[model samples]
Target chain A: MVAGRAGGEVMVRSPGRFTEISQDECLELMATTTVGWLAFVDAEGQQLLPVNFVLHGQDVYFRTMSGSAISSLADGHDDVAFAVDHHDDIYQKGWDVMARGTTARVDDPDLVAQVAAGARPRPWAPGERDVLIVLRPSVISGRRVRRQ
Target chain B: MVAGRAGGEVMVRSPGRFTEISQDECLELMATTTVGWLAFVDAEGQQLLPVNFVLHGQDVYFRTMSGSAISSLADGHDDVAFAVDHHDDIYQKGWDVMARGTTARVDDPDLVAQVAAGARPRPWAPGERDVLIVLRPSVISGRRVRRQ
Candidate 1:
């Protein structure tokens, strides 16, 4: 029984007869995804907000400004929340993964270029082309809800 | 020009007109919708995951367990991420919200009962009924990423 974090308990029993997934399975799930959301606290103390994101490998990435949520992180405050999930109303089944970690504005020119080079500018919003931020996971976990 | 997190000297300008949304506007956006994603970091320090979520008023609400992503937050961790966004896939216009805050499990009988009363447990892979988690955003902000 894994000790839970906040208000409840988490029970991850061994999947005996069930199809249990390996780390490879987890990686496989993240590969095809393109977008995600970042949870950041605003400078003023209100829950910052979730923003559309671009998924790249195990790294969650995005571009934003200093006046908003992205800025709060870049200003040297790295406490942040990042999440990714998929739910199909038609299929009625889905999976969710959440990450808590310190986010930093990538400064290394090589790393910045590498991430920026491969990234497809998120077509939805503006300012996606300028600054970039990455959330490195300190603790990552997931839950799958399925109905038979 | 707002400084980039990467120090790229990004302008951090709005997409103009419709792209600017305040924190209150974001709450309205969340209310207009039912499903969003919650992200948290687990024990493994991986970019954990995303789960489809339901926003309950000011706080973001979802059900989770010990081994799941929400479980980490329920464990009483301060770092948590919850987000909600919607976009037209073809039209490429919409808003995205990112929230970062500390997490706590709901023990409030009233809140728990309210969540149980209103939350219809849709199994993503089963086993959500046993756990309850809610994210109270400390900093809530969002962007309307509509093209001008």
Candidate 2:
């Protein structure tokens, strides 16, 4: 199997001569997913929180208060990563897709409204926030685990 | 926020402080808990499978097949990452714990006997395996989401 560059601690897996996912699989998984974690920097310089994100077509979107994480992303501060995975219960197999890209706040009132109209956000949470953020993935990668 | 270089992005966070958990809290969450994902680098690369993990004091243990993912970790391919998160009824509030480290196969017969004598490696699936793998986390990080 191909291995990515091995750093001091974290090993970033690079593309190699493996059976990487096809376009169909990516589209299927991406379409099936609705919620994922939005990784961004928060105040106090700590990895703030993993906010809930929903996928629409080729892009990722989420709603947040005028929170610090949103400000950091809007200021062209890249460091955005979002992940969504689905696993089979009986077979114990599934795939996870992670996207690395820059995130932006959608100022176009129409686009933001479209997202807000579709998303339940957190069904259990009260109230809805008006602002929406979009993430444009620069690098797309994923892998699966199955009984072998 | 100081951004750290990793993967395809940078993460800025407080070079934050980690708190020592109460023993009771640890047992309630770690020991009594049964569902969590177990990650390891297989011959095919990084693999994460959900399983029931039990805590023996500070050390967490789980059982798996004598082959596949377990064997990959034993071969010393890559460090492992195991994680579990639970949301409260409201879905807005929850806690997630991430542990990063390696797995060591139990060898000493007595130690094996001791663990087998009392501990039960509750597999999510109904089956058994001779190769019982114990997960020892080098660092455990967790967070509690509060309603603000």
Most lDDT-accurate candidate: 1
Candidate 1 has an interface RMSD (Å) of 8.0
lDDT of 1 by residue, A26-133 (tens): 445554454555544454433424454555566666666556546567655455666555656665555656656777776676666666556544434445346567
What TM-score, computed on C-alpha atoms, does each candidate reach?
Answer: 0.60, 0.51
For model 2, residues B1-148, the per-residue Cα lDDT tens digits are: 2223333222223222234455456446665455566554344433445555666665666655455455455444335666665555454455666666667776656555555544542333333345545667666767655344
- Report the C-alpha lDDT of model 2 over A1-148, residue by residue, as the tens digit: 1111222111112221123465457656776644455444444322323455666666777665454445557655465656666655566455667666777777775565565555543432223334457888767776665433
**Which residue pairs of candidate 2 clash?**
A4-A14, A45-B13, A45-B14, A46-B13, A46-B14, A47-B13
Instruction: Please state the interface RMSD for every predicted structure, separated by commas.
Output: 8.0, 15.1
Chain A of candidate 1: what's the TM-score?
0.71
lDDT of 1 by residue, B89-126 (tens): 55557677776677777777666656555544433443
Fraction of the true interface contacts (Cα pairs closer than 8 Å across chains) found in each model: 0.24, 0.01
DockQ of 1: 0.25
